[model samples]
Target chain A: MEEDPVELVVPEPIPEPTPSAPPEEVEKEEQPAQPTPPAEPTTAAPPQHPFLDRKDFYIPPASRLPEGSELALAKAFLMTQSEKSNLNLYDHLTEVIVRILETRPGNVVDAFETLSADIKRSHFVVDRPNAPGAFQKASEVAPANEIGAAQVKLFEKSGLEEPGDPEAFGEIPDIMDLSNLWEWAGVSLGKEETFMLFLSLKSLVTSKPLQSVRLWGKILGAKANYLIIEGELKEGAVDEDAPQVEEEVQENAEEKKEAEEDEDVPKRKEKPVIPLPREERVGVNKYVYYVCNYAGGPWTRLPDVIPEKLQASRRIRKFFTGDLNHKIVSYPPFNDTEAQYLRCQIARISAATVVSPSGYYTFDQEDENEDEENPQPQNIIINPEFESLSPEQLIDPANWVHHVPYILPQGRVTWENPLGQKGEEEANEDEDEEEGSDAGEGEEERENVEPETGPGILSPLSSDEGP
Target chain B: MSFINLDDLPYLTLVGFTLNTEEKAAIQSSLQVKKEQEKLEEIWLWGKILGVQRDYFIAQATKDNLFSRKFYYSIDLVNWLQLPDVPSSDMDRISQVHGRFTGDPAFEYSLGEEPEEGAEEKTINEEKRLSGTVALINYETEIVPRGAYYRDTLHQLQKNVNFSGIPKGELSQLTHYLHFREGFDINKRTLQERADAFDESIDIFETIANDEPKGVWSCQTERTGSVAILRSLLWPGYVFFHTANPPKWGSMYYGTGQRNLNIGFML
Candidate 1:
């Protein structure tokens, strides 16, 4: 079975109720604190404050969020550059990538328990005093990025009888050195891919091999903000414990003064956009793994194993111990071993069917109900062929990606039976007289209600914080 | 401070035609109410002149400036039949370039005033143009905000604020319109008292503290970047401006455009 991604859409949020008095208002009066409605519980567990998750795969201050967290992060990261390079790459890729994370009818998921890395950076700076601007200044030195196809593990000569130690497969290469590989693109400013519909990588989800220390070591040493994992390497999967070395740096490159904001101009023009790591997989014949994605985030000195940074920054420790989400999906082994896994997959989901109120689609059903209910029902189907299915056999709602609303003459409109009313259109005069109403009332009243048209108006009313 | 760009000002001038009665209406057919409405319609046909955005709109002058209580006529509702428009279809062509010819007999003849109704006839050699046309209100605008200028002070006075808490039944007819309190309370408040209070507060916020430039200096070749806020004419429905086009030809020219126009209906 494919590692199908599922999406759920709640109604648009209404404005939260204002507290009895706003915090600014609270500054004035000495009144007793008035109890107010509490906020809704966030999806992340209570113990995990969304802002502290420090898993190794860190989305830099400027990278586009995982497909799920895109919008929330869009407003959040409006002022930060995700890459280390001073080159203005964020501008080139941000909007396009957002268009890519376009899975229809889904809300942003809280993949990182913590607020984005940029917010933490601000809170780190403004929230403290005595500290020098060194941390902020240090971030200004542009980061280098690398993007290459994924190396998926195809088939390890199955360990028949007794297998050789799974450990001695190959020597772990130094990650930072750009010279050890078949290919590499250093300081790649942004990353992007064209998502083909119905083609997605799911092997990343099923092969959760975190048990190995070598893979962890390799990730620990990688010097890229966004690491793109490809399909080929995934076939020959590396154990998680692969030991890797950080790339040597060319010292003496100077750091530029970061942007100092002023009163009038918008600070947005100053920030850079980050590109997330992309994995590429192709031509998986007889593949065992279905599909999966791993966005190799920014290069970070992982404090999980080396906790010096963790000791100094509770924020960092919290990310590793409490917030990183390790996703895993599994399936029964199939006869075609290699066909089981897929990597570097991309898919395009369109919102074309989302009609007026938003985005459109419709359901088509059999005509068995022609003599039944007042306004007949139209069945929603999976494919456009409109093959009639039993009411119970409609396309599974889970896969019915509602990128937009249902629209078109695709839905059935009831026709007035021609045999029943020859003069139905002009029956108003006769009907009123037949109903025994007064003379002046015969004409339609000023309020002639129209049949609903166009897109249904989604309520713009903000969600009330409380009753 | 950010520089003001030309694109910010909505328009160079606002030509609001305030109907002497209702701004919006629902068609009703009661003969008695219709009769009263007819009288209003007739009166409004040649209504009394109120005022303009300020003296800024007046192309020419009146006998009074300092002694004139013209501010009371902030937003003037004029009777279209009373005051003649520039009369010629060539106003767009008559801008300042050849405006010097404005004083010629031909110009006076075009105005149908060669006989010099309120003005004296010049001797054959006398300058065809009157000695000079003065502005109604001369504003000393600068980079800093002139409070009254931004408030659209002249337009504010024309607002009818004399309502005595609106009659109980008229609640359904309309809601209170202005945000700030108006001095007058309609018939209940003494007119003299309302007038005094209004006059007292009129010049309070006259100086602009954050003075962003306003108006279009456009003559076709060099265009203002933001069209929405060209000149001081406000874009419909937009009340606030966050951007402006840079000044091109000049910094701030206290010109004829800010002159006051007579509103109210002119019979």
Candidate 2:
């Protein structure tokens, strides 16, 4: 998929000033307009500062380049201007965003491009937080500040700031490290798209522990920030036995009570055992979790805060596993969701297993219980052309190169540490010295120091470590 | 190895047991009777105990006696009743020895049920079956909780469990520990007794029995294709004591996790 370039705001078309009188009058007006600005500057100009002459007041024609180099110059000048003022960088960016959104909604792609561009611009100067904020969302929205004073104040009060920008390095960052607390560029999507994105992330983390991730995106048509998170992949933490959702728990308890009250007619879907996705496929002790902080819909509150600003809020409403949120994520038959689940399983198995050229089907076609007359699933798939290949050709390593991504080779991580080796060598030297002393005198000396009598005839216990 | 070596006689005395002259003769005669009547085979006197009215003697024999075979006898010194295979009695003796070693005083000759104290007549059917028929020692064994030596045992069990020079008298401790650590429940009463009372066969031991805990366990099935024990230790603190037979892994059909949830003694 090709990504769209950051869009520049198309300025409103300027209206043409009507021509007053005729072309002669327009020339006279133009002459006065040019001469009067010079005459006024000449009358007010100080003779001591010749560099400030009327002619010098005019902007150079170099600024009028059509390629929009003027805009970059103007931006640089404004940045210098803001450095003198109390305006903060982030507040300035937020004000820019509010003004853009204030415009009539046009192309979605263009809007996203503009939004990301403004974000990247602000991200360059955004302040780093001194401490991690409390897990909660900011409820109040402050007035937008053209000079980012208010945003700065909010950050100062909350003791939190947006994630650091990677563009500061002048290069695109690598894919977010799954082992670290990674932050992705926020996006606004429909509820369905959000669910799909969640599924994709879950698939990625299934093979490796996604320690932490913060994805700040808006759910379309919702006024509140909708946050869905697969919680921390902590080891040995079994999810709570019962469903963590309060409503589900209540429904289950009520159904149980009613079942006790009545005997014969079983209520369908009452206390319906919500099956967790991939729970059966995964290990019983596997601890994969998730959380949906806010499930926003049409009836959700219209919070004054914007999504980007809301991301600054440290409020984590709940902690849960992927199994808990599986209730909301619909896994339909033969869909991308299912395919992703299968892919994750395959990736995990591939990581743990080694594929070999000597490997073949553990069971033969004849061993399968499927009817011979009926269409067999294995038969439906075409087998690789192995018959024409020689035995040596069959075991060729080139044929197995595609599996490289699945298994990480040991050599890649087995870098030798000189410091560690030195420590080991020193310890070994100490052990060798201890063994030498324990050998009693020396090998030649021990032969000469042998007991004078034959075996079993000893002088008994001696006052020494070795008796 | 023979059930008891001559060197172990002093250890038996330390445990408050001593064999008299007549009791020793009776045990020797009983072994002779078993050898003659049961088509002749090598035998070893494993344990000898003097009871109130009769002397209880245990003799182990094998066609070869080289490999670990589960064949033993419980004989009465008075009648010379040569009972071939001690059924629940074998498990009882093992349970007592393991209990003493592990400091579990609650261990007894039965499950939770108290054993009948008074003398009881041995059934003719029990005697006949013991003389030649297969003696199945099926009992629930307690799994040691994941504490102390759990990590150590788990690491060691991952390698081969070799009980090569381990004494037969002390085999109970090692066997019970291995079985328990591998998530099998152990007790004095046989699984058959529990099954009979419950009206269903609740033997999960068969599923995991094949996995010789390191290699300490003696496999009854000599040489068929062996199945690997499903490793349920997904995380350090997490524990899954129950496992399925035929090893459930990468299968389409789902089994209930509740059944796999352990309901047994910890430690």
Candidate 3:
């Protein structure tokens, strides 16, 4: 009986030109009386029509058709005209269907109307009124380009000017060149660190109106090391009375008053302030310091150094903990934190050891032209007539004179701090008098006299003097 | 102390211990005077060992031979006090005491047990331990490039004046470095290992490459690959740097003078 049904079903031919006919129509016509098992062989046979050769347009046997195949074929047939016209019918239909399902409107036609109105109101699909086939507005086509331009403007507005383009800023000095100079002196922060510092310092110069910058040195700390960069501020950029310095000075003065009260010492009258010999731009405070936790971290400017802090720093030896706010608890307590201590140490190091070859700097002869009674403090200027010293003389310590002043024990180059108290000044004078009375100590007398005579040209005799 | 000048002093700043210009000048001048007065063969600043009160500035000198080198230390740069010679037995006793230096040369550490109890408690001075510790570290981790010194006709080890330096490329390799101590035992190596490389006269010390508990030495090139900096993992803050072209070298210890005893576990 099954054989008869299979033979009957196989012999019949249905001529169909369209591939989009529904499966139920084919099922009802082809297998009217046959059971499913007997109809399988006839269904497996190839379709007689020529259009079935196109795989995507081919219709499966009615019984074997997958779920949703009829709806898929209908959608495909509807997209055929738009495909040749460069339209994205598939994406549009899928988006509309997804929205309809999401909104689950009481009426399906209403959802499409509302979605179209919402998209128009939001300007997601910009419409050109005069164009044919609903063309989009020009502004909606190139949004990426606008975003990129806005980002460029943001960077420019932030003042983070890109470095290494010489055209913009005429030939700024490369800080990496300093690595070669320091290496010649047997000092370096290694190649990797120097390059990183160079990049970071270049960024720093752009943010601040700096005339020049250099890697001062690295200060190793217990937790993390600090990379120090020294820079010269532009002419009008320097803040003479920085707020941090003012706060530190006030705190120091209060501490001093408390200490004096504890000692039961009589308060003395304030003396006439002596004007500083030279501007802070020339001597110990010439360079502004910035430190970062690492090569590329945010740089923090250290507070200006005060004389009392500088003196106190020399009395104690401690390692930095890489924290600017770390309190230094020693016998003679540091008034400020590690930042001030670091500044004080830098001043001391620069004052004592920062040397240049002998003729690189010369005493300002113009200062000598002033009246001797009220002589201006001498300034060291770059020598126009500088002649390089021989290697022999350059190697000798005697030839390397300090350009900066010797920071006296009282912290200033001179004892006449106009801002200082008369009691402290008198105490310092008494100490000097006691040292002067000791005739056997010729070395102490020379040290006391060296600062008063201006910058000491290092002599062979001076190396013999020990503290 | 010509080996350590103001130029070379900045290298110590890398490892974070620096003497101010005054202290450095004083040390340089005073050491030169001491060298002349004592007629020493050679002298160089060993390093600074930190103490609770004050740091110890150590200077090492050789008298007649490298093996006869002595160490002198100072709290104040003006005075150089020779560390007392330590006997072999005291070296073991010194190992039992571990702590930061008191900055007092006279401070004594009691070892083993309380004196009031029945058990005997040995006492050791900080000065002796300082000397022993320096000697021990030197014997273990102090290294020089292989050809830096050679055996003379009299079998005396002498520095090679003609030795330019270890090449820059080979500097970071551990095999190029040898311990600057005496007593190399060739028998410890396999026959294949010593087949072509054994020489009793010149090869008088072991190579750092064969050191046990691997990864104890970290060698790196710095200063745009012109200088080599080698740090000891076994001794945390001991650093050695050498320049190939100009042929300059120095080592400084800026740590707490304590051995990294957990090195085995660390590896």
Candidate 4:
């Protein structure tokens, strides 16, 4: 028996995506488990300056290139590189991004070609907020701008923008350090066909505390033209109870009660959105997550807003969708509405997970008593997924990977920082002092410094700090 | 060469526990029992009190007098307990001591129902395990929370609570802090005697139990979201406490302009 040369995932197309096709749930009772820029030409605060960005750094093209590039799709490359771990360089990063954007086309297609044309031309001449935006503003319909007029319009129409501020990025455990946020990007692999991507500055730069890192992440996502920003926020140190989303939703919904957010995001044709079943497969908490090939159908445009609507992509999507409005989603078993879209997206996430070596299986079992024999429904179908965002896979304690995206020649780049970070920068000065002490640096030190000593602390602040 | 210490503790399902220095001291102290000279007999007792019966500690005192001591805190128990495969009694005694060390005076304990006063912390800890077969100590002494306690003991208990450790008010200040512990001699009680409380629980020397605070234990509230960050620069070891401030990273899930939300107690 020979393997099929053309198939990315071998065997029959695991049809587990179709939930109604007879629920063949393969439940993995497995345990569970920044960017930005802007210059304001030096206004806001010291931390807000573009001078904080490093000038020498440049993101290298990914070592592994996606297929189909150079043929159907143009070669994807990072537009600019300025963010660095040094906090002093943030201000410079904004200017660098804007400077890179001024010359390069905003359009995703021409973006690769336009960089050299305006390499010397400076179109991004310092614009303050509302100071007649320089590039095309990604409005309901993208308005044309300086960098590759049609290209800017194209990328803007896709609705992708730099990642947003602290208010936007959430769920980062307080024990995590956002400064080295990009180190976690090693797991995500992007698609050349789909315009979807998971964009972040975590892999490209470093910073302290999770908040500022998150803020920069939002901007980079928006600028890099990411379809979905699936990163998490800082874990609660106080508010140790569930923070109420409905309160904010109700208040926000007043403006768009029941808005139609369910226009385009895709749904798992067969499975329903539900929580992941309990399975203790691995005890090692994972920081590596995957964004799959499912491009939730086109943005689910909505008529009004509800609190839950903002949570996910739904048949009746209500929250201000970063990707939906941008038209980044193109495939789906769509929910009748965006409201269904959110639930549908969640369903798709629960219905299956990315099986390593490229298998996609339903994350939760629809059938309580699944039969292993007989034409048992294939719980996981190894599909040739391109670029998909499954938060359900991410939130799993066992599977969640606090990932940061690297922007370069290829699309999504994932790299893990071997140092491992939680919060606050230790300056890593220990390297200078202890370089010679590593001779016997084996079981003894690890035994002395096992990360689990604190027993799975939910936040770095919860560690036994001195009284 | 692989650097995992596989020989130390067998990895069962999850790692069990290894007692640190403080934990060892607690076990030693709680396991200490005093001999009661009823009238004039100077009978010596050994083995920490396993429990309290009325006014007497249902203790595991040595039947013979050889182990008796005027007060031998031990240079050997530390070395002895550290030996591979320490006895189960030592482990039990240590756990009992840990319970006492971290006990909060404001915490009210009710093993089934409240005991009739003068209960000892060690006895209280043993009864927490629902097996009747658990209390090996039968009584040579009793430690009761009386209606008349001095200011000393109350100060110690108050110092070890979740809130007190949080750098705030005294837990002993609460009137409801007095609980029926291990001692109060029930047989000595005449009819119409409640015998289980102190008029001023604020007075020190009263023993308190340690358990999850009433409302925040498991099975309470919706499955609240939590993000555990491991910051080595800060404190190490297990630190479980509640904070009003939620983590900022959670907001990344919502994407752009969404407010970051947090929950209570990040353990």
Candidate 5:
């Protein structure tokens, strides 16, 4: 019974409520209960300490955060929030954040305010005259002028001119007119491609002040095709002592050596050699060529075509690989890569094929009898007295003639380079040595002199009429 | 011979075989004169074959039979001299001479004697070889869109006047193109392979899809999917173009006349 009382005392705080309890016993119980309450608090203190140590609002460290958490947060925020009536508040906030991040201004709050204000100022506003629920015409709600203004702003931001603006093209030839002209000749780049090319060409013209620009024909490559554009530079646009002149001298020397060596070979039968006509800088090299892989691709200007490269290109047939730097491995090794080859071929094709209606152009008759050593430069002018040929007369082959002189095997209009008098003297010495080796070839000597006296205009015609 | 439009030559310039205005005019007039002089049932400009010295312009003409078309070549566009017939026996000999044409009809290629002992040395001239090669190329790679021609009841192959054209969607597939040549043996095909209802009138030729050493023909859609261009890998520079709408088709061979021997390895 005594053990039971001790057990009751040990197990129960309820014993304090019993009246049978002594005053000293009650006091002892109170003391222990107070300490027990304190003990409970002591036991819970560690967990409470962790909670107390946590920040008021928590953010996971970058390492602990889930992948694409920002995107998830944004998606959740967008889903929960209703759009503002007149503005995309979410987009505005995002743009503000981006600007703040990019610029990282010292006073972020101030920067944010300024950026938001600037964006609001520039934002395209739609004039809403009708009440909230009122029916409105489509054109009234979105006027063409406002749309065009927005488009112009977008084009300006992209650093491109609006294609529809006539002034954007500046001096570039009108594509519609060019297409119509080419259609008469039975040539077309297709409707969509022509428009695309025109837009690209307009951008090209905007970059520089060109006197004239024309779409040259495409050259197909093994991998891709080249869309060529020919443009004439304004006078004084290029330097007089350009790198091309130095290249021409070196090329001529190599060509001269090759010609001399070719004469010595016994097995090969050579074609009748004609002296290249004098290099008319105003004639051939006047037009600058730019090529691009596609209609909208960036254009690259090709180097000036030296006569040596042109002559070498004539003897070989190769397919381009669309890479401008591709080396041509041929029997008579090409000196340069595909870019120069392309330029040379362009020069050759244009000279051989491009033509105009008879009497469309007239030669400067005043310079007709200029000194052979130093022929005065003459420009062919548009004939004011030109008369359109009837369809009947136009159908005849004899009625049409090539306007450009034939690019000879030596790759020039005249046999000797008038600019390089020293080179000409060396060529004479080599020719004398070649003649000495082929002793007493009087017939060959006469043939060599024939081209110097022959009329240049009639040469291309006679050659076309073959044996 | 097919009817070729001279206007289409300008489109061919996109592939690098451009004819100048003078050449175009000459060809137009010369073809008309030759058509009258030869009394050709149909005639067309074939293509240009590049040579070391000069280019040979080819013209094809058909008389009584479409299969037996005659070929004429000219160095100077004014004259169109017919190429002589090449015997089948000399074809193997001609194939041995694979060098580029010298532009001279009289140039002879001495194809060294056959491997067998006591065999005489063989030789073939440029003209005969040219004819043989043209025939070989025609046999192997010449193709027409399905239904362009139909075999008549009397077994005569005639151009189908009512043939609208192969559909634009079907143009890019090789199965829609057929080798326009004789000797398509239907009996050789398995019963399962011939399960489709084959119309004898139009399905008399072999489909180019079934050609051995597959991928021999490269088919592409151009001009905003309005025109289909097919190029032969075996003969590198042979190109054929066809348009579905308005129904126009033509082929041009502008090459060195050398077979692309690397085609096997490339494939």
Candidate 6:
């Protein structure tokens, strides 16, 4: 099945409710039944939160929500009370979660738990930090003063070292060389920290093979700040307790094959691996690994790894972690520039289209309109072709590809072609003719609604049509 | 394909016109022309005013083999001359060029002053061009892979070029247009912004080079690796320019010819 798509679109404008009839008319309706006595007015209910009041707070119809949490499925059954109300409670809940994550000042778990049942049903669960199991029951109890603290404690208690910190787990292996790697990268570490680096290498072995070990060793020796660590090699000398030399030969053969195929997936740039090794193991020292506080070297050393020197210094650890997005630092602190820069960088990397600088000769597909009086060619960029898909279908990761030839039409042919300027005159004439015809018909304002001819009076078409 | 090799420095002295309403509008419209064959209309017109005539156009300025077109009001693509040891602003240099020509009576006469109440129409004298003429100056242009000049600073050219004699009103017109289009000081913009500005200018040029209309035709010479064209946008008459790859012109043809005039292929 294709990935579910996500898209951001401007919400359609909601029309305001029309004013009710005058108070006198309402009074007349009340007194219509033969001398009925007036009852005392009751106090109105307090307003609900906007998020809870939204249509999606109610369970959606089966048609609108094909897949959702158990809570959403339960709510959909209750929504049968009204025929007009059909909503997708899960998507609405997800959007609410995302909004809370962005704007609210509370922990993600606390925020979700504090919302009304309508906003977040008890059965709905989110894949948040510290919760690894699929669809774990959501917490109903709101933790006080422990915003995001429990998640950290859960990891610590589980005997898992924090990401990028292998020494905390005490899995340092024997016969591993790390001080040499740190020295090459110009990183000064204490004796204990050097031992930690050795363990970190062993930790990396879970995700990487002996070939990865060889490549990383070369990278460390070269003083490169960043290196991609593929997950631990599954089949290795360690499984059979074979000699380390034989394992090296086997890994080299595998790596050569992988390196050749690397070109096929060019979009997967900087394949850094965050080794989530379950446990540290020692096996004839078949591979070596390196770690340090930071990739503290001149960007020149890791030119291929971190080519964009503009963002090199800030992106060191983030680069190494790869898909394991475990984080240690809070973002958008007093100085939020780094956070904003990272956002733009991510957007650039994620975009499927590439717009190269102009004036360089590339394929000139702009000549399609060369026959016109004026040829206004636009800068080349990919035009997305998501045929007939709703906004939900547009956000799929699969939809974004590097090569899709869907360029928009080029610019106008003539700047001041007197011929094209007559559009306004013709529109005005049509309006005038319509008015004249209406007058001839002598029709009453039965509908009392404005005709939807042309764009509204305030539109550019009206201005241009005017003298 | 035969090619003409001309000196590049002199035409800087000769051609002049502004991105005025009529001219800018013409070029803008031509750039946006839908027909591939007509895209070069504005460029051909500009080139024709620069005295590069082609046989394809039957312009009012061209009557016979004998040359008839004149450069009364035209825009030139020329740089301001920087003298050694003299530190002057680009504005002052541009002012000097304008100052030299605005004083000429013939230029004043060509601004609709000479043809008094339809007495008779007369051609412009080549030496006495007007002050209002625009001189597009772009220095330090890098030849991109496609042979297009990218990131050349026109605002700098506007500031440092001598425009001494041009009236304040005319000068403001040029400055206003440049500011409106490329921003007041384009150099201060980010790399992406500068790239965008340069790309826009190239879009205009690309339209002119590849597209040919009734009176406009441009083609790169196969023999000499230069682009040559004839056009009549600048004046009532046709002007032609044969620009070599490095843009040193060898010969120029100013005058008129019948419709469907075929100047031999440059290539």
State the fnat of candidate 1 relative to the true structure. 0.00
Clashes of each: 140, 26, 2, 195, 7, 79
Over 4 Å off, model 4: A1-199, A203-226, A237-245, A248-347, A356-467, B1-267
Better of 5 and 6 by DockQ: 5
Better of 2 and 4 by TM-score: 2
In model 5, what is the error at residue B161, expressed in angstroms?
Answer: 22
Tens digits of per-residue lDDT, candidate 3, B148-252, equal 778888978888788787665456677767888877776787887777776655566788888887777766554434556677777776777776676777777
Tens digit of lDDT per residue, candidate 1, span A1-467? 11211112121322211222233333222111111001113322224334322212233333222234564355235323434432122221322222223332244344322223332332222334335442322211111112112211111112122444544332332332322121121111111211110111222322333221112111110111112222223345653422121111111111111122224333225421111111122111111121212222222111111111111221111101011222212122111111111111111001122212111234345535444322434333344443444445333332223422212111112222211233354334434544444322333321232222222212111211121
Compose the digit string of candidate 6's lDDT tens values, residues B56-153. 11111212221122112233321111111212343333333422223223332232335668576443432222211222211001011212222335
Docking class of 5: incorrect
Instruction: Give residue A295's lDDT in candidate 6 (0 to 100).
Output: 20
> A1-467, model 6: which lDDT tens digit per residue?
01211112122322211012232332233122111111112212223334532322332233122235673456445323322233233334443543453365656666565663545343334335345444322221112113224333433433665466443232323423544444332222333323333444454444333333322321111111123222223443343322233344336535853664575443114432111111122211112223221222111111011112212323332212211122323222212223222322332232223222222223346546443432334223332432444556445433333321211111111122211123355334433545565533322321232322221111111122221
Docking class of 3: incorrect
Query: For model 6, what TM-score is found for chain B?
Result: 0.24
Q: What tens digits encode model 3's per-residue C-alpha lDDT throughout A307-389?
A: 66776888877656678898876756775788988888888877766677767888787765444422435466799999998
Per-residue lDDT of B144-252 in model 1, one digit per residue for the tens? Answer: 1111211234543321233222211111111111112223234454678557533333322322222223221101100111211112211111111111122121121
Q: DockQ of each candidate's interface versus the true one?
A: 0.01, 0.01, 0.03, 0.01, 0.03, 0.01
Q: Which residue segments of model 5 deviate by more than 4 Å?
A: A1-186, A238-281, A365-370, A374-378, A417-467, B1-137, B143-229, B233-267
Off by over 4 Å in 6: A1-467, B1-267
- Mark the 10 consecutive residues where model 4 chain B has the least summed lDDT: B249-258
A1-467 per-residue lDDT for model 2 (tens digits) = 01211122122322211111233333233232233333444454423344432322443334222336684455344333244333433334434443444453667456766775664453323243332332222111111111134223333533453345432212211223321221111112323323333443433333234444334222111111223332234344343332233354346546864564466443222422221112221221122323232221111111111111112121211111112112112212211121123223323333233233322212234536444322222211123533344667655543331211211111111112211222355434533554565433333432343221111101111211211
Model 3 misplacement above 4 A? A1-175, A238-243, A251-265, A268-282, A367-377, A417-464, B1-237, B240-267
Listed for every candidate in order, the interface RMSD values in angstroms are 34.0, 36.0, 23.1, 23.7, 24.9, 32.0
lDDT of each: 0.22, 0.29, 0.63, 0.24, 0.65, 0.27
Root-mean-square deviation of every model: 34.9, 36.0, 23.2, 35.1, 23.9, 35.6
